[model samples]
Target: MLIAVATYNEIDNLPIFVERLADTLPNVDLLVIDDGSPDGTGDWCLQEAKVNPHIHCLHRQGKPGLGSAIIAAMKYAVAHDYEVMVNLDADLSHPPEMIPLFLEAWEENDPGATVVIGSRYIKGGGIQGWPWKRHMMSKAINFYTRWLLWLPMADCSGSFRAYPVKLLKQVDFDSFLSQGYSFFEEILYHLKREGAQFVEVPFTFVERQYGASKISLQKAMVAVGTIFRLGMKVWFRA
Candidate 1:
């Protein structure tokens, strides 16, 4: 398995996240895709990779967006012939300890689920530290995405997910329209078209303790537009 994290100016959180992940899953390889953070987050990852054979880093030019970073990681995983690729946030909001559950779910469902999501909207799942407005925005986004994209899962927007590399290799990353957070739903929509099966495992989402959120009103509007366009495609097909 290749565990990946996309980061930007997450120096304070990356170290703790890495340590916790390493403690939880020491045998897995970790890849850090950094967007040239001015705070030297890439530098720290490069330095850590030098000593830790299990750790790797890929430094990009600038803040390109989370979607591209994840797509890059997917290509890397395919090239390396990893069986599975797991992605989570670098801010520790997605707990590394829950990774084993994802893997277990993926295995138990052998030839059943192509993706396993760490869902916060299912039973036994919840969120902490987010304002009511943030919660409403999340709920609304998930509702619309599921309704429009025809995704059956309860959570469609979270980044904590495990994918089969074979299924990823079947996807054309270059064809993706979403270049930001909406990539999550966009990819799932495509994967669903490929007859992919999904499994949702419950997990709590804790707010980041360090660094600020990268979400913006502009990005949210873009996501809305992208999903709407995709939804229209679904409508036309139906």
Candidate 2:
């Protein structure tokens, strides 16, 4: 199994996150995809990768997008012959300990799930530190995505997810349109069409303690537009 994290200026949180993940799953390989953080996050990752055999880093020219970073990770996983690849935020928002549960759920399921989502909307799942307005926005986005895309899952926008490499290899990453947060939903839609099985594992989402949020109002609008366009395709195909 391989674990991947997409990073920007996450120098404050990346070290702690990496240590916790190493402690939680000591043997798993880790890949860091950095988008040229001027704050030396990429430099830190490069130094760590040189010393830690389990850690690897990919340096990009500039701030490309979370989606492209993840796509790079997926391609790397496939090329390296990894059986499974897990992706989570570089910030400490997603718990590393829950990764074991994700692997357990994936293994225990009959025939195994192709994608395992660390969901915040499920019964045992919850979020911490988000205001009511942020909470409402999240709920609204999930509901809109589920209804419009005819998606089966409750949490459609979260980034903490695991994918079977075999299934991921079947996807045409070049054809993906989403180069931002919308990639989460777009990838799932494409995978679902490829007959991928999905399972949700509940996990608590803690708000990042360091640095400002990377998400913006403009990105949210782009996500909404992208999902709406995909929804149109779904409707027309039906």
Candidate 3:
């Protein structure tokens, strides 16, 4: 299993995230995808990599989209023959301890369990620190995405997800068009279209305590446009 994380300007959160992940996932290999942050996050990763053999970091030139970082990690996992590739946030919103639950779901070898998502929509799952407006926006986006893309899952917009590399290889990266937060929604739709089965595990969704969140008001525009655009592609098979 490869635990892949996407990060930007996470200097304060990075070390803490790394430590927690290390403690929780002792045997799993970790891959950190760091977008060039002026906060010296990339340098911090380099130092950590020297001490921790299980930790690896990929440095990018600028702040690219989260989807690109995930796709890059997916390609790396596929190339290296990692059976399971787990994608999560480096901001600590997605708890590292529950990773075993995800792995156990895949252990069953059910054809219907290709992607296991850590979801907050389930009974034991909940969110924290989000304003009512932002919270409503997130709910609306997921609702619209579910209706438009027609996925059976309740949580379609979370960043904590684990994919079987074989099923993940079905989609073409060039066909994946989202460049921002909507990338999570788009990829889930694409996975369904390609016959990848996704399962959602209950998880508590905590807000980040580090720097600012990546999903600002600007991402709302991208989310609205990208959702419909990708919806048409999936709904109409365009």
Candidate 4:
């Protein structure tokens, strides 16, 4: 299995992240795709690479969108012939302990499962550290997406997901237009259009305790616009 983390300015959390993954996940190849964080995240990964044979790191020249980082990781996963390519953020919001949940879910429906989503809206799933305003906003977005796009999935904005390589290859990477955090939403659309089997597993959605949030006024507006545009595309096709 190819386990990949897309990182940006996560140097401080790298050590702890790796240690937690090492303890919980066994025999998984660790792939890090760093977009040239000024804090020497790539450099730290390079040093760790010396002793850890399962760890792989890619350092880009500058900051790229998370979509590109995961796409690059998928290309590498394809080159390595991995059956499943899992992608998650390096911000510790995605707990390393949930790796087994994803593995079991995938195996139970293997050869047919296309996507396994680490969900925050299913049973045993809830968010912590988020204010009521933020939580409501997320739920509002989820509801709008479900009504507009007719998607039944609870967390349309989820980033922690695993895809069987074959299903991923079905997506037109070059044609994937969304570059920001909206990429996750776009992927859900593509998968839905292709009739990919999606499984949602419950997970605790922990808020990031460190580092500044990348979300901004601009991204928020863009997210709304993207959803509207995607909803239109889907609606008109019907």
Ranking by TM-score: 1, 2, 3, 4
100-167 per-residue lDDT for model 4 (tens digits): 88988898886444589989999988889988978887888788878777787888887898888877
TM-score versus the correct structure, for each prediction: 0.98, 0.98, 0.95, 0.94
lDDT of 3: 0.84
Alpha-carbon runs more than 4 Å astray in model 2: 110-113
CA lDDT, every prediction?
0.93, 0.91, 0.84, 0.83
Which structure is stronger by lDDT: 2 or 3? 2
Instruction: Write one digit per residue (lDDT tens) for candidate 2, span 148-227.
Output: 88899989999999898888888999988899999999998999988888899999999999988999889999998999
Candidate 3 lDDT over residue span 1-238, tens digit each: 8999888889989888788887888777899888888899889998989988888899998877887888889888988888889888888888888888888887765533388988888888889888899789888988998988888888988989889888777778887778778888888877877788778899987888878887777877888788898778765874
After TM-score superposition, what is the CA distance of residue 221 in candidate 2 from its true location, in Å?
Answer: 0.2
**For model 1, which pairs clash?**
none
**Model 4 error, position 138 (Å):** 1.4
Error of 2 at 94 (Å): 0.3
- In candidate 2, how many clashes are counted? 0
- Best by lDDT, which number? 1
For model 1, the run of ten residues with the poorest summed lDDT:
105-114
